[model samples]
Target: MQGDYQVISTLLPLENPDHLEARGIHVVRTDVTKDVSVKELKDFLQKFTGGRLDILINNAGICYTMPATDTEIPNVEKMFAVNVFGPMRVVRFLHLMLIEAKGVVVNIGSIGGICPFVYGSSYNASKAALHHYGNTLRVEMRPFGVRVVNVISGEVSTNILKSDHGRSLPQGKWSSTADPAPMGHTDTRAESVFYPLNEEFQKHVHRTPNAITPNQYAEGVVKEIVKRAPAAWFWFGASSTSIRMVDVFLPRTTWDWLFGRMFNLRKLADGLPSQIKL
Candidate 1:
């Protein structure tokens, strides 16, 4: 980070670019979801970093919360585009620099991929795909001296969630998750069977109110990346360790029951008719 540092994102950091420029860090406005922007980034890096990149972090991601059946096709496609394909596109264009420098590729994944958190079906699937991609990429890149590290991240204080009005919540603040808010971009359809769970769905969106600060998560990730032999998958961030332990030790039925209770699924089940027409 001390030498030749640059950050690329679809959206620039909120802070004045001057602040980062003052410290010799340049921000490039690039979109990973587009191949043209990714190629442009590669071109910029070729000139800026002298065709050598020591580290590449695929941190661009987006999330939406809703029942899987209720999730629109476009929403699912968009999430996969940004969260899964975005990383793959970036790596495809930039892997040469990473290979030249014997560098590391870090994919910021989520624990939601491992745990069946209600209302995060598509978001979870995207992360699961990313986690698998990183693991396989590691094997493929190893021959070229490139290291791929996948971070099974947990909750962090970031504006990853948007309000029903399409405004991002506050960054690094608990206020973002303090009150339940409707997560769906559209209003719940009255005809949908899941309409009765609207309140619970909103609550699930704001479930992780006490998330770790971004700085805290970053510090741990940096440490892992700098290690001489970092593990293939590193776990860090709020509740990450606990969730990993639960996944490792708990039975599938226990996990199902726990998540059901956590997300109000039990109540919904209790209200349903015991005899099924099907």
Candidate 2:
């Protein structure tokens, strides 16, 4: 059994300690956004496992909710650094180890990557790129017997929503104004309109009414790897199934309209608080 696995993530979740220990899983912390940090982390993994790496889970990503118009240029770079390039870096560096063992690479993406959101351009674009990259890599690595699985998850109860990167309604400089409403728009104020819409979008979009735990997600990954023939793509949690259906069946124009409504874009364009700027 190739029991040696590596989980790369930015923050070491408190739940991870016990979770990993119980499953005999070895944990490694790597700031995926930094090249030097990733290299150091890879060195540590190579040394720790005696250069025998089996399963690599590219699960580290940062989520942010900033409207496309107001999203900082730097934010897009940072997001891609972690979400897209970070996984590619790991795969490229760990290729030698995986090739030796004929191991598996699991890239964790998001539902947003497949389906766009109003204030989630940076996060969405990064994941979308990741999804494509994983697909291409899977085909390229076929001869090496190295399987690549792109895991696209819907809404799960994670720290993403509470993270500092997430755009909050009343935290930054824009929040202090008495009425951040642009002009002449009473029903469609940006601040007042976007906050509630964001909440509602989250409510209906998730597949499961309850949030899926990290442990639950981890278990699914384990199952897929253990199978004789693992699937190329895995969609887990409640929201993921529905989102996948939408991804396959909906036309581009329909998706645009649906996504616009989901993000309250029309309202925002109408001078309502449609977008929650980070």
Scored by lDDT, the top model is: 1
Clashes of each: 0, 8
> Candidate 2 regions off by >4 Å?
1-25, 164-210, 272-278
lDDT of 2 by residue, 81-144 (tens): 7788889887877788888878888898888888766567788888889999999999999999
Q: Which tens-of-lDDT digit does each residue in 55-89 have in candidate 1? A: 89899988877776556667689889999999999
TM-score of each: 0.84, 0.74
Show where candidate 1 strays beyond 4 Å.
1-24, 163-190, 206-208, 270-278
Positional deviation of residue 272's Cα in model 2 after best superposition, in angstroms: 7.1
Q: Against the unseen true structure, what C-alpha lDDT does each candidate score?
A: 0.77, 0.69
RMSD of 2: 6.6
Q: State in Å the error of residue 205, model 1.
A: 2.5
The collision pairs in model 1 are none
Cα deviation at 125, candidate 2, in Å, is: 0.3
